[model samples]
Target chain A: MDKKKDILSLDEFSVEQINEFLIQTESFAEILKRDIKKVPALRGKTIINLFFEPSTRTKVSFEIAAKRLSADLINFNTSSSSLRKGESEIDTIKTINSMENDLIIIRHSDSGYINYFAKNVPVPVVNAGDGKHEHPTQALLDLYTIYKNFTNLKDLKIAIIGDILNSRVARSDIKLFNKMGMDVKVVAPSMLMPEDFSSFKTKFANNIDEVISDADVLYMLRMQFERQERKFYPSIKEYNKFLSLDMARFNLMKKDAILMHPGPVNRGIEISGEVMDIETLNKDKIKINAQISNGVAVRMALLYYALS
Target chain B: MREKATVLNSDDIERIIKRISHEIIERNKGSENIIFIGIQKRGVPLAKRIKENIESLYSSEIKLGKLDISFYRDDINEKIKSDVNITEIPFEIKGKDIILVDDVLFTGRTIRAAMDAIMDFGRPKSIQLVVLIDRGHRELPIRADYVGKNLPTSLNEFVEVKLNETDNEDKVSICWI
Candidate 1:
């Protein structure tokens, strides 16, 4: 597939593509450590962050990535866009998309709508987070962080804990990590598990200790209380009792296994604060920060590779 | 059918590299603050050759670094997927006279990207470009500081540099359709 046209999902990415991206991201990560964190790769180009959903982390990282690449940027959140005045989503996006802009980073609440925008627009489209469908960039940054730690992705055991039915990050991560040859498994209650688990090289478990005893990486997805999915479990306390990453379960994990979460932790619900605080990654920083730091590099790689 | 011509033979390659090394020493005044940072593939061998020549001339050591400008290129973001190479600058470049070595100098964009990539490492006191062949058709305002051979060409022509370090041979050729 022509990734430069649009980076819509991880499914279209091959092992060569992912590895190439990770290698390129290593340079961007090194750039982040320098006194100057900007590059002139996309100087004459323009980028628009057309985020229909509210986001502080993803949107900010993308903005930083674009700015670092010297691309002209425009931020478009739904509340400030024409969609606030009863304008159709497609119409609002199309109206703002002119010949001046070179790329559009879109985040919408509707699944698979990125393809609609990519089809209608002539410029490149990057899927920031499209509903519960996929968050390709987030998945990429996560993979970068993990790849940096483990050095290799194949045959490694990755335990993805917490909400599975509603996390956009988990959706992309499963597809990508699997494509990279990792043994990925989901640990969630029956209600939180998706109806189909046979689509990829993934396993499902209703208990945490039963699945993570030998896991090399522990990835946590937020409980997604905001999605407000109905009565998955009796209560937060009960969910924590059964599935949360407490000290006991944490000890069961491989001593050097990485702890990762796409930030804004639930504190006491999906993962315990104590377990999440044990920082480990580049320069001894927490994995969450590492993930955030990596987001910029990975996005820079994507933007530079897609636009260069 | 296509037309082909041999530009520089193996012995010519060695002699030109030796001459370029001496010229670099003469211009940079003894190669004290200078380092050779090669572009990927063939540039590495050319840089190494220059380094060896300089080392033997004055019996002095000089550092060598490799700079890959794949992602830094302007056409890297096009529809086609290109191979990404690794950049290894083992030592610092700040305040030193830097010489960027490459095999071909046609569009000048690759060297432009290399200069930009070098800036990210640190501000080098000065930067110079050395090319084995300078087939003149520049899209940007760029000119090499040193050249082995200045071969003029049209837009449709391609310069092929084959060296022992990468391709299992030693020669420079030109192809035209």
Candidate 2:
């Protein structure tokens, strides 16, 4: 196995590396299905989750992944940490580094912060989410989820809908999908798109209607309501009309097409509330639950990959 | 790696497997309460062959499974030469006697990890090991119950077991890197 120091971004990974992680992820996923859902792979190793921003799924997912592998984990949140005491970021990290954790998982509000922090740290650093930079793990889990639905990812048409500009998930997903030979199409209103969208190497679309009939995967990205400084769209109704995956749009998608979201999904914004309901989510096409569950599996694969 | 010597040919491997299968059945009395588990890669084929041999000889059905010890390995990232294979042990092993199969047993770390991986599924009444090649250099206090050829080799030498199922040939050789 090639030694990967840190999982900072999907752009840094080759398609082969990504494919290896996805394959190893299936082995981990099998562990989750067993009665004893724990392994002693990383026994006695310590991992620390250092988050400067708020998160629910990503934080818990890492914690679960570490624990399932029988590794000690410490979660450090910004609200309770020494960051409030005017401690410098370097000092805080250096102080944590002194404890000699095997790996450091960080989620910072600033874009590209993890790259600099990873450079300073001796141990491997996994970027949980770094502003608008990247969420590589999310992309990995999404890829695994998609791979589960559609065996081969090569040449698969994946239409990523919503918040392309400020979405770190979108940035990571596009890079990963493109690397894996997927035909990626980003669908969002012009206001929510990045000016340098052409550099993303994905087909740009102003509406979801263009790809709804043919796309193999409908990846709905959560709108970064908090990240926006100004109004990107007119209103929720207007956003729903153009971007939201309503029943009409959902029915138009191919019978085998899968619906994906890097969750905490905005029900009415990116997808209709009915489509995301428990009954609808139970269907094979909707994979939100699988994504969340696969998140733990994928992270376990990654944690094992980095620290092993 | 350079091949040092051809320790066992295809016919030699076949004869050893037959002898081991007879030993396994004779020791266990019958295949009634026995289950065979193959450690991933080469072990799966060996286990299947043993199970088939016993079935054909005694006309009894024996449960077989494939175990991948990658996750249970102490050296997680180290020595992972191939991708993680699927571990499919469908049936229960709560009190059944398990015959753990492997192509070669060297430092005994792989067997140790295999044992740990098996325990995760269920507890067995007794776990006996079957190895085609037992290269002498025991890192842990582990031993195979049934052995094919006990070829003693130095630490620098490697024992390579090739099964017809995986390598398109049945042969065992000692190699030097």
Candidate 3:
């Protein structure tokens, strides 16, 4: 019998398990402050970072997390792998699985590929990201960043603004944050948010200013024009006019509210350049860099939990 | 359930703490250059108790810290989530006489890991071990410098130390099946 679980979906975890992971991640964060950051937690273990999709932030942070834990890593990306030579995704995955890999951190463009791999593969699998379905690790890192500021998540309000249609980060965040008892609001064009809402409760709005005043956290998603298989809006200019968080919208939100973006943010399309350019004053309002640091810690915790 | 018996109560625990505090001071010649770092969980309270005893007698604040050695463990079942505690060493450990405290000294693997973790901060002048219970074993060639009590037992037996700060009571017990 398989004794442990593969972290394929964030929604599969109970509230206690998620909280425990956060607590474990906090300990790793403390380790990052030491002069020597490496620890022997996952020594003698091998990891294969299988990324079928393009990613810099999540992939790089996972590499750093694995290396910091003293685990051996092999970066199996799409461009370098034999998949470029017309090999099937299954054959590619099975080829990697044939090796002595203890864990596989996979990022694929197709939704639910991780779930398929988790069933067929013998060793544990972590969903770094799987298409537009879920990006569990990114959501975890975002939660860790938000948790550092507000201890009481029960009463917090989060407004996720931008291209909700193409954002896997937004989907994962909405479900995970909702499960943790936070109120989530999605601000985007009507065509972006689906009618069913996938059984996850969230308030939807097309106007950014309507959701700004009550938000404790203004989470901005990138306007992924590259992922636009078909045009959701008339143009980028029209989308910016309706929902972009420019200077005027930034000032309208609560002054105490912090801004969060799962990186490669479409600078002027989703949020104003001024908002991202703002210098850190207090820790509560500090953004971006803090998220990156927390990303490494959260990933370390996830790897440690999945393998050891 | 398993067979268990308490060997040390609250008052006995207090007296042992005081004696260990005095032993630490006398061996180092003074508390000025001394730094106390406890292995997390039960060790934290014992370290704090000794620091208090030194402060009361010498009327000076001493450096006390805590170390979590979860990441350094060699034998752990990865199926379960490992319990991680905080390691807060505020001051630098360079050139300081460090006393590593723990509740029980069994196979000495924990002390070895704690020492390795502490060395990452800086090179200390020397490292000493203080344990409340010195259970006999031969897994590693290590020994405690100052011990509260020496209890020998069979391989099946295990020592359990409960501190008021963490466990809501002060006592030591031995458990065996």
Candidate achieving the largest DockQ: 3
> lDDT values of the candidates?
0.83, 0.89, 0.86
Off by over 4 Å in 1: A1-4, A280-286, B1-3, B56-59, B69-84, B107-109, B116-121, B137-145, B152-156
Off by over 4 Å in 2: A1-4, A278-281, B75-83
Question: How do the residues A93-176 of candidate 2 rate in per-residue lDDT, one tens digit apiece?
Answer: 789879978899999999989999998888889999999989999989999999998888999999999999989999989988
Better of 1 and 3 by lDDT: 3
Clashes per prediction? 2, 0, 0
lDDT of 2 by residue, B69-131 (tens): 877776654543236788888789999999999988988999999998888889999999999
Model 1 lDDT tens row, A1-308: 44455899888878997887788788777667666677666777889988888899999998999888788888866786567788986676668665478888988888988888888887788999988899999999999999998887898899898888888899899998888989998888878877775674588887777776788888888988778656777888888877888877776767668778898888888778776666542234247777888899898888876664
TM-score of each: 0.88, 0.95, 0.96
CAPRI-style docking class of model 3 based on DockQ:
medium
Return whichever of 1 and 2 wins on TM-score. 2
Cα deviation of A104, candidate 2, in Å: 0.1
By DockQ rank, best first, the candidates go 3, 2, 1
State how far residue A22 of model 2 sits from its true place (Å).
Answer: 1.6
Give the candidate order by descending TM-score.
3, 2, 1
